[model samples]
Target: MIALAMVDNFPSSPGIYLMKSAEGSILYIGKARNLKKRVRQYVLGSGDSRLHIRFMVQLVESVEYIVTDTEKEALILENTLIKQHHPKYNINLRDDKTYFSLRMDMKEPYPRLTLVRKVPSDGARYFGPYASATSAKEVLKQLYKVFPLRHYPLATCMARKRPCLYYQIKQCSAPCCGKITAAEYATLAEGAALFLEGKNTEIARIYRAKMNLASQDMRYEDAARYRDLLRAIEVTVERQKMVARGGDSDVFGLYRQGDQVQMAVLHVRGGALTGSRTFLFDWEMETEEGLASFLNEYYDMDTPIPPQILTPLPIPEPAALEELLSEKSGRKVTIAVPQRGPKLEMVKLAEKNAQTAAEERLAKESSSATLLSELADKLHLPAPPRRIECYDISNIQGEMAVGSRVVFIEGKADKSLYRRYRIKGVLQSDDFAMMREVLSRRFRAESDEEKPDLIVVDGGLGQLSVLNAVLEELEVEGVEAAGLAKSRTFRDMESPEISKSDERVFRPGRKNAISLRQNSAPLLLLARIRDEAHRFAVTYHKAVRSKVMVTSELEGVPGIAGKRKKALLVHFGSLKAVKEATVEQLSAAPGMTAKAAKALWEHLHEKQQA
Candidate 1:
């Protein structure tokens, strides 16, 4: 539904549009203060009335735009084109274990707090968007029960000579034995940034004026350690949930059943509710532009931005996304929409916890679509593979061979379509020519990846006849493979019993092996995709046998050949970091040469001067 003479020469300023689809792809990405009155509100459909944007504006076909000289540079180029074109009708929010936070680095000397997950522009103070990594290590285990701070790192507590069981329990101020003072660990890192900025009554009135100045200097054990730091800051602010009596907000909650969306937020902070999260997904558009592109990718500067934001719906350019979340959460943020009291009953308890997190994620995606249709009816296959892929291989008898693969989709594990390979022209212990050179270099690669709808292979019936001779020598058709095996045991020689066997499977024209039933959910999902492709090929064949034992000590040194022995094992990633480097870090590695890094640093210290 594009052509209104293709947005009649667009430019009514502000920008970022995109739409596309009909071969060109990007089916949605938005942002605009005007771009010709928002592509004339989705080409006269008045922008978004959602039937998921009128079936994505009848498959768009073209709308492009860009412009950007402010509407906050078209809200950061529509969040960098919805994170580089993940634009399938917007709202991804897939990244999970929600932004951890906490950090501290007030130019260090003794400042700790820690927990992270990306928040670096390093001036450092941070706090949290925390709702995981066990709520930012349960708020750094209650800010180490009253901020004595320094829980390690000042170069590992200045290589600690002593003082660690968190300074024998007063939860650390050992500052590695100097027991505090860097202005008392910078006043316990300003009372752990005012108890993670919920400002627990100005840090319990500065620990009640340091427990009444350590009880007027009589110092009864520093006035009972400031009366146990105001009773552990009033028992962690009496375990949260107040929901009011103060401010720092963040409510937002919307739920949808069609186009499956969820949303939820809650948080509240000083006014308490303390945590809620929810996001769920499948959105197609207009819940005020998916809660305004989820509050501009959930307030990015690694998340925590609550001066206020309580939406139910008002979005589009809400004052230029409150000036881009008040310039990346430095503060003054607001987005409200209330309409009654108790902030619309905490946005209807974040839309009843986003409709109980979208009916517990559609009953865990309808029990992973009935365990992928009972594993496509016990692997007779045709449909429920829902992108499987497995492989395996590893190597020790073959010396550093590799393999791996892994993936699984509808029934879960998708380590970003895992993969691995490396057995270069099978030189030895042939596990069927190293599983036919890792399944013919993963089905003769011309990669954009996504192909598998089932391929698993670990072993049995000679690894399903080397994956049916590498998919009948890569004429590779719609995939479907199987092999599995593992479960052996035996032992009975008269009264000393043992016996084991059940795992099996096999398939490709099955000449046997099918067993199953020992704890079957399709044999525990084909033994969890053959033990995650044998733990991703024995963690990449123990990192290629420790870089082939550091390329056999750079093939007995001299000029250290093979491209400076693979550029000093890819720049010193061990032979004990190239035998503790330095012949000027092996002549600054990459294909070395200060006379071959002083003959491989004098042949790696000539076997430590024998």
Candidate 2:
């Protein structure tokens, strides 16, 4: 009744709406062309049969809205709110890996191309949001082969006295040592830019002209270089199928089953299929709304937008979306639902890819679910543990001790929740003490709502007892705990007996260790979790140890104090580099005077000699 009253007051204009729970937490966020009409559908339950909508409607206690002059503004506002609040009922897309882009600021005196995740709006030409960092790096490698632009850091190049290996290998123009003039470097940069832009014919023409001029001047070496460049360009064009058949565009295909959705985007550049990106979302919404929300969020201002976008389903408010995209891309943009021809074919291809990816993902998820069920049964857990936290400690003779906590949700690692701790309370190599300290600190930091269903420690009954004591002291209830340890075999001293490997699980209140069957799913899952925790702890321990060693090594030098050590490390990059540096280089480093540099150099060399 209250929801209907709130809907009655909604304005009949395009805007964003927020559905809140009793405690005012946002349950869902949505955008609409007509706020009043949209809100009424949810409040009255008029023809909206989606399972999630029915569920969300039951939780929505109050409603709020922000009126906008246009649907595009509402769309933008909805995306921002969804990200900020992470509404429980919205289709949330969490992509941890950001694609890489090749960025180069042409305004710089000696422009160098570099890979970056974010594209700054500082007049730099950005080439890609490549499918992966490796793909972007491969493109950079190819560019280096054809264009000898500077590849080293600008500061390093400026400070260097001679050309490095890249220059010697003809992969760099060596602007640091003046091997190439500014004008010549600019020409190379332009050629590289054109090549990335898929203007291969223009680049080939320029290379051919350069080859002719070099031959006419009787510079056979230069002519041969240009010939090779032309050949590389020709091969790349043929391989990419860049035949000037189609303009730049992006095709989006969507697949949905129950609450699971998958989206695939195909990027076409210069009539050639360049790359594709796949995204998965787990939520329910109308197809048009889902597609609209995705389109608005995926193509942010910083992301490169193609001139034309093809969608499997027609998006709501095409004109408004087109206008917003045009403003973002700085050109006219079109959003179309193709019915026939090559554009339709591209859409079909994207849909096919999406469907295949969805199937694989579902199969993997089903296997994970089965494994979780099996594990719960083996452990005699009250329910299948959705989130399991594993703890491990790593140290070498009680020095540089560290502990790691790894989280797994439904048999998949949730890396965002993983944590590391320095074993400050325990100075000695006591696994029991280390486990207690780590668990106490971890539970103290996390709220009850964030607690894991199960806690796994790496050890035998001793470690399990420590963890159980800590949990009891903290009064943390409703959580199960266990420890994993390698089984030991006993043999008679006077008689020989066959031996076998045994894996054991130690649980609280159990008089004897639980023996798991060999190659069982539950045993394997627990072993994998324990190994991952150990690996994380060891990695963190090594990093901490390295820092300690570097600090200690620098402190041995008479005049190198903490500040000087930091400055030296920051400038020279490492302790080994500082040790290998000459007196002049050391003096040039920040915070180091000539006298101090000489003294430090002598002290390091003396220590090495001794």
Highest TM-score model number: 2
Supply the TM-score for candidate 1.
0.33
The reply for model 2, stretches above 4 Å from the true place, is 2-10, 21-23, 37-62, 94-96, 141-151, 158-184, 236-238, 241-244, 378-382, 486-521, 549-610
Q: Which stretches of candidate 1 lie over 4 Å from their true place?
A: 1-97, 100-126, 130-135, 142-205, 212-214, 217-222, 227-295, 298-302, 306-322, 327-330, 333-386, 389-412, 415-452, 455-485, 492-505, 512-610
Per-model RMSD to reference: 24.9, 4.3
Cα lDDT for residue 299, candidate 1: 71
True-vs-predicted CA distance for residue 229, candidate 1, Å: 6.2
lDDT of 1 at 168: 88
Residue 424 error, candidate 2, Å: 1.9
Clashes of 2: 0
lDDT of 2 by residue, 1-610 (tens): 2357768888999999888889999988988899899889877778468777788788878888999999879878888898899988676664546668899889988899989887656789988768888999998997898898888556556657788899888899899899888977887898999888888888888888988998999999879988888887787777775422567898899888887789999988767787898888866667887788778878763568889999998877788889988887778999999999888988999999999999998899899888888888888999889899999999998889999999998888889889999999988878788888888998784554488899998888888889999999999988899999965777777869956558889899997888778889899889999999999999999999999988777676667898998888778656766777789988998888998999999988887899
Query: Residue 308 CA error for candidate 1 (Å)?
Result: 17
